[model samples]
Target: MGRRRTGEYFSLDDAIIQGQIVRVRCGACRRAANFLPEDLAAVYGGSRFALEPLFPCSKCGTTDFVRVTTYSPEIADFGRITLRRPGPKKLVQTWENETFTERSRSNYVPDGDFRF
Candidate 1:
């Protein structure tokens, strides 16, 4: 028998505007903290179908991780949710060599008179 894939849960009605965080067991670690929703999207965003590994536990010396869904306000459809996990964590970690670093993280700072 195979282990069940974890399901993501979120309450939209009267729920917090910020999406909730979900924790799932790691097949290798057998622990519930194997991977986070934030991390999942980072590692597996481009695949046609999202696929994550399962381990017996969290510390099982394996790279497989559990999967769960997250409620994103940016989603277009609610019935059929689609997620595009971003790439590795280090891909955009430092702006040292990025050519567009300034433009990417820049924001307009108005003068002192623009109080709202």
Candidate 2:
């Protein structure tokens, strides 16, 4: 979606400067990173959306991009606080192959079962 002049709560520039939560994803490389307007205004000074044309994909050397979600700590998703205490520690074995990671809700399965 095109950047809106006024977000549900604040303007795009306000979301960038004050919210500290502007992000964009590379259309080619798909790399996503925090976009700080404080950094952008230096080289290209203009309305934030206007500067969208100047943003180049640092990963793929292309200008293609799409703005992603901008998160503000003051605003909670769907209106309520979403942060919760950590659940039980995960069983992480670094030496094992990454495919061995157990995502299923079942009890622990052996590493051999995880290999492709």
Candidate 3:
């Protein structure tokens, strides 16, 4: 869907910022949720805009679920933005990378042979 002019989304003509309460629905399970303008703005940088409502999987639905929304200023196009709480995978990858680097460091020797 196309985004409307930034002014259309805001009520106060002089207010630089404005937002609306919106209902979001899960594309997979169709579970719906309400999000306040402030929360939406916080996720999208608090500007007048329209965004695609992305929802979480039923199994992963929670207050911490990720949201992919967008925002556009008066003369610009809405850009995609993501709101997410890091998941287990992110933690695991971080730990794994750290461990790998540590192991490599431990195995290195000051005079280890080097070749072009």
Candidate 4:
């Protein structure tokens, strides 16, 4: 059987091509923000993924109350609306060191004895 079409747009790429912008609102905290569809698609996955499941509110960190909607911006809405654009990605490198001494070795007991 052929796949059924669910909505007007199949993917984020489709939405972007149609000049749609994504808006997310958090019910609990009343926090709202707009984002570019391409920015979200880059972070979460490719354009084939749905936009709704990709956002968790940055402030509240809850997906339960998040609402995702896409709309094409009007000329009047240009300066009035602010969008959260993607920033430069930062790669942090961390190094951990482990030291072992005779005292530390004595704390290890075999046979699943966890007493220290």
Candidate 5:
């Protein structure tokens, strides 16, 4: 009924490398934005699965987001081919389409680049 959870698309480290941005909406105001990894790291000290323990909306001071997702359209479209998450535009307006690149976004090395 909503955007898929983080675990559905990626493991913790995979989120960091592949998540171009995180899309989240305020529970009370319905305000939403595309947050880059740097933005989330500033708030949660990490990018993966960090939206929990909800923080207040800077605009409304509400301590919750109604929905969240790793929003990358190119990946989403590609994911659908493999039955992963739906495209970002199908659910959110703030997410921009990630242009197709031949390089695999699945460069999730278990030990070299990410710890977990």
Candidate 6:
């Protein structure tokens, strides 16, 4: 069977089934990173989700210039390749003050009332 499509692009599930990892790079900063398809599928809906709009370079934060590719790593790449892994979640609480104020309206002058 052919690969499933989300709009015009193939789904991330296709890559996961093919045992491929997603590589994202920032063209402006030249920063690159590898991510697992399964992990992404879980967070980004399911395997059928479009791979587009998924990669926004964390370092440079440029989604327009980001490039996404997929490949199966070779055995020799085990030590050389470094994947971007998720870190522990932290929750912090903050307090904000809310104040309500009424604005005063400015006096209005019509165009005909103005003196040259």
Off by over 4 Å in 4: 1-9, 48-51, 98-116
Q: How high is the lDDT of residue 5 in model 6?
A: 42
Tens digit of per-residue lDDT, candidate 6, span 2-109: 333445666678777787777877888888888888877888855554456585677767698876777777787788888877778655545455554453224333
lDDT of each: 0.38, 0.51, 0.41, 0.70, 0.52, 0.69
Clashes of 3: 0
lDDT (Cα, tens digit) per residue for candidate 2, span 1-116: 23445434434566456544455666667776654455555445525453253556766776755545555544443354333222476565454444535674365667753633
CA-RMSD of model 2: 13.6
Candidate that beats the other on lDDT, 3 or 5, i.e. the better one? 5
TM-score of each: 0.26, 0.40, 0.32, 0.68, 0.43, 0.66
For each of the candidates, the C-alpha root-mean-square deviation to the true structure, in angstroms, is 14.1, 13.6, 13.4, 10.4, 18.7, 13.9
Error of 1 at 29 (Å): 5.4
> In model 5, what is the error at residue 33, expressed in angstroms?
1.0
- Pick the lDDT winner: 4
Give the residue spans of candidate 1 off by over 4 A: 1-18, 27-30, 34-36, 46-58, 62-116
* Candidate 5 lDDT by residue in tens digits, 13-106: 4445665555667768877665555555644556346344335677877665556665555744553422223344432324345666776466
| Candidate 3 lDDT over residue span 10-100, tens digit each | 4222122434334454555555554554554545544534344433456656434433222233333234223233235422212233455
- Judged by whole-model lDDT over C-alpha atoms, candidate 2 comes out at 0.51
Candidate structures ordered by lDDT, highest first: 4, 6, 5, 2, 3, 1
Candidate 1: worst-modelled 10 consecutive residues by lDDT: 8-17
What TM-score, to 2 decimals, does candidate 1 have? 0.26
Which runs of model 3 end up more than 4 angstroms from their true locations?
A: 1-19, 54-93, 96-116
